[model samples]
Target chain A: MHVPTPHTPLPRRPFDRSSFVLSATLAILAVLTIYGFTTFDTNGVDMDMALDMLGDNAKTLFFAPGLSNVTIEGLLKNLGVTVALGFLTTVLGAVIGMVFALASALNLAPVWLSVVVKAFTAVVRAIPTVLWVLIFAVSAGLGSVAAVLGMTFHSAGYLIKAYAESFEEVDAGSIEALKASGADWWQVVGQVFIPSSRAALMSWTFLRFEINFSTAIAMGAAAGAGGIGFDMFMASGFYLNLREMGAFTYAILIFAVLLEYVATKLHTKTMQG
Target chain B: MTILHVDNVRKTYGGNSYALDGVSFSVEKGEFVAIIGPSGAGKSTLLRCVNRLIFVTSGEVSVNGIAVTGLSNPSLRRLRRTIGMIFQHYNLVNRLTVLENVLHGRLGYKSTIAGTCGFYTASEKNRAYEILHAVGLHEHIYKRCDQLSGGQKQRVGIARALIQDPTLMLCDEPIASLDPSAAKIVMDTLRDINTRLGITVVANLHQVHVARDYATRIIGVNNGRVIYDGLPKDLTIDIIQKIYGSEAHDLILADGDTHGTH
Candidate 1:
């Protein structure tokens, strides 16, 4: 069973330059980010206070006695609101992102326009999602409307990059065949690009939906948007109801896992067919 | 009647060298013409110019006496609708069904909305099914195209091109990617399609024997210029050597079917 085959051995995998550069850049970025975070202190806390807080949090996390006070109906309503926000933002982002993605695809759009859109999306992606929500709160006031618009804006930026990359990765031969068929620009996009990239678009949309779900929760907590996150924020920050936070956390984790399972199944099915 | 005419066509890529230099040819209705050449000999460049897939740097190309060069976008699209082009790799949308891929052939004729929604008419669907059957792929009609084998994929490519009801069909190395047996089947299908439809055909071919067997006439190209143009029977061994240079022996004799397999 342990005998070696009398054939040439497989070539050793090389640590390629691009991977090396990637890891090196990531290492540097991580160090710098840690240092930057260190500069913004949350007012120094002694080790004793940290230990006490950790003990209290751990007990609440393990036992979750506040589960008795948590009404299933109230919890379900807030969870539904959070899920709706995530769904709405993802759908709207995909719609708007698709239009911009087409214009941002290198081969499809003119150079100047594509460059401008690409630059704009990069900036949008660079900003944190919570910061975007807070910025919008200043104008639209702290509410669910601001949360929806903020999440949609940031989600559009994320989906734009994903959709554009998907479109660009489409096989050149398929595009060439359509172009030579004398199909107009719109026809080519409608018939060729969209169909060829359908699976990729779906996969990207699913990934963005996961991201938006987390961001929607953050928006609800940070910007006073109405969702389970707002209630959890109150329980943790104002009332210090650790047990309620634990329950909400468990619910969020279960929903996330369910969504992920569904996405993976759909992705595999689409890839195979 | 003449269906295509190219006069002194030259395509340059911002340099002194030309991809196609002074290429001139004319095709009458129902002629099966094959352009044979070595790699990088500009055979593809020449074929692309006839359909205006790539514009020529200088000179003229006309189809049915209409100037293909310098035509407006709409005019060019209208011109292209009448001509069908197939590829070596069988460029089908793999995610689409076999019928849907074939229906794409009519995209040039349909409005953007119709093409987008895939509103193939009843007659068009019937015609596509018939074409699929003709290509011996009727059972695979509903299957996604990626499920097919290489030869079967190319058959779908042929059916797609045929659905356009094209007057002129241009094939760029259609059999290059296929295996020996698959190559023979594809070549036979192309030959049958040519004879049955009486459509004028222009094909780019790499294999000498395949072109000689399938093409009524062959044009040899080298260094972006035509070196020989005559009936396939008139193509001498010496001429083949001249066209392919040092690579002729390995390419033709090694295939062991220089006299045409089928």
Candidate 2:
């Protein structure tokens, strides 16, 4: 005699705190945006003239694209410089971040040391990368030095958090097994944690490299670090040449796509290995 | 000769509740002992205290005649190398090869730089191969641990522990997650290690019948205290009732023995 039990359903509440909060936040932002648009934003906007000029600029930027101020070789050389900047800062950040990450990982380091390292990295990460660059400009005199220092500092802060979390997420059971086998702290990290978290670490490092690449481009114009971004700045702002701006934009877009393809391939290979 | 001793071991969580309340036991060398209890009965805690993986709140634990409580960190690690531990989860590194994971057992004997560089000598590699062969995992030596089946993974775990050349082996629910057939193989392998290598084995087991079938001695626990400690044949229905309390009714022992009717 097999009998199925009757199902009794519980009453559902109409109110959900999380959804209500989200809706309320979006409503407030909508109201504030509407108020700003209606009140103070139209004084100097010149809607009709602005729309006409925007249409013209878009046409010239997209349809008639050719570099007049710089040769293809010069543009490529400048692009290489930007890439080198990104690579240098990424390597420096990875090395320095790894040390702090080890000190900050909960399972590996003392509680106090982990807390101190995490807090310091948190503060550094809170600051915008560009702001860090500007701050370093005061000391390093607005050249490649300032850009490299600022970018490395910010990248280290970002990667320290990423690397520490990956290390912390390594299976605790594996760590316990190693410890039971009499592995010391360094040995446990080397044998178990590093090997286990290698894929995550590599992915995070590549993600940071991508970020540093874009930052390097921005710093080229903003901090006088010579790269394609300096030439683009000249084409768009100083020279006001929309065609040259379009050409530079296309070059950057192609390179960005290639970088993504490479990163994806490397990630897949490492995961399989 | 006694190989492991737990003297009045007490473990408390958050200053109030006792996980293990003044538990005491001793095991002779080459004995296969299974500590059996329902979940939350301090079976795992007692096993951890033997190796000082988790410290005992009070009382002393001695392994091979050395007190485990007051040792410094380096000395504790030095003492740990002689002991091997296996977990219910088969805690081999999933991304690493079986050979690499087995060689991890030798990490305690190497310098930090050598270990970091993964400089295992040829003899160590040969020993790892032999252990893998013994565990029937030689065909999967180059396979990542994640690719192995549950039984194969547990065999890899056993091989890793054996490569330590340990005097005593501690297992925490070594088969709680396995299927019945896989569980049988793991238990059989553990019993073989006990008999063949003469390594003392202490395991926490949840299944009463499995414990009785494999272990030479059974120690039953309930509510943080040992209730029954004797030969498996001596664990009658009444003693099992005392050890398991109200839950004893659901248990069916091997050879058609159920609670209260035997």
Candidate 3:
């Protein structure tokens, strides 16, 4: 390998505590990743099955019997359910999170309260989303209601943390100026926080929507939420129909891509506006 | 009538040292008082305390003879509506239009729900535009603040303050961040507002010559206390030397040519 000329001395920078934490975290992750690779498991080798599914099975997966019926009815209905789950949960999370977000902002509310809220959300976020879904399933029994509530609960954690952080980014002077003008808390929030961080907050909400969408698909399959993902689960597991799985998978990919594209466009528009 | 009566006002930040140590001064209605000080001489802190932007540790700050120290938030807010303040950095919300920023001055007058819903009365909007026109920013009222030059931004700041229809205006280093010509324009606008509307004006200024030209009275501050307070003509070289110390030499160097041209 050709070695490039030794680089010149770079200007020194003061790495903050966060930077040090990030570096330490990355280093630990690298070590864990290397150890995992070394101890790699391919014990239950289904290499032939995987290869056969991707290659020979590709034709049957796409062109199996009842493909037309699956496309019109099965695909549309499940896709609708999956999309609704993502949409409703995200909207609910965003609205609920927004109320708590204001109370959670250090600038807006008391410091102890903000810190308590922030810590509580961090703990909620720490629990895995799948585990959250399963936990809800026990109480509510396996259904779409359980899935929606579970996903919303998890999403509230994400939105609250992100929204409060976004609120914090509003100029300190802006808040002070408003408060000095004799405007109360709600007026101050309406006039300053909403306007100052409008684009940023919108972008964050959209990002949360994107995340919840993917999680919703997973919930549909994992917890019997009756969406495209559940149909996908049935196609892959119970039916033994490879083509149905392929169709469902493609349907999901298309939907995800479209949603992402729309989000990007919307984010850009809001930021510029 | 004395519009401001700050009696032995002492303010300390979180640290033990006083930002304003037993500082006391009073301003009459329609008088332009220039607070001249060196950097970090607690000029900003003093002005902020006057408007109750920051709480005073243990002293009295009475605006229009109303004690500000013990007033509840609602009462303090009502008191603040009559006292307009502009900043060195022109604290206009950058994303909002010049018109929107100016309208913020009228927020204190509106009901909580009305302001929250941004339902400004039609007259309030008209008054905002009139103030913008007074500050020479009416043409650019639709433009967002971030798009404006520093001078234009200060114009928006002035308009925002003016739209409050204030009895007293507290300006903290209003010309500190502007170029010479822009500073001159902002100073002229402030002087006009003081003259035409008879609003009591107290501005912290760096350029001693500008203070001499615009301010009816000059108050020199150093080390968290007032060292001098008198008419601009009565502000002696000895007091300037005492207030600025060695830094007065640099002020002379910067002042002569700029002061002569205007």
Pairwise DockQ winner, candidates 1 and 2: 2
lDDT of 2 by residue, B1-262 (tens): 9999989999998768899998999999999999987778999989988878899899999999989999998889888988999999999899999999999889888888888767899999999999999988889999999999988888888898898889999999988888778888899999999999999999998778878888999999998999998999998989888887877767744323322211
DockQ score of each predicted structure, in the order shown? 0.69, 0.74, 0.71
Over the full model, what C-alpha lDDT does candidate 3 score relative to the true structure?
A: 0.86
Model 2 regions lying over 4 Å from their true place: A1-12, A31-49, B253-262
lDDT of each: 0.87, 0.90, 0.86
**Candidate order (lDDT):** 2, 1, 3
List the TM-score for candidate 3's chain B: 0.95
- Candidate 1 lDDT over residue span B1-262, tens digit each: 9999989999999979999889888888988999998889999989888887788999999999999887998888888888888998899998899999999888889898888777889999999999999999999999999899999999999898888888898999998887789888988888887899888899999888888889999999998898998999999889999998987887667544633312
- Cα lDDT tens digits, model 3, B96-116, are 899999899888888898888
lDDT tens digits by residue: candidate 1, A1-273: 787788969879987999999999999999999999888664687767889989987987757645544588888889889999999999999999999999999978998999999999999989987878778888998888888888999999999999999889888888778777778888788877888888899999999899888887887788888788887888788877778888888889999999999999999988877
| Superposition error at A130 for model 3 (Å) | 1.9
Candidate No. with top lDDT:
2
**TM-score of each candidate?**
0.90, 0.94, 0.91
Runs of candidate 3 with Cα error greater than 4 angstroms are A1-54, A58-71, B258-262
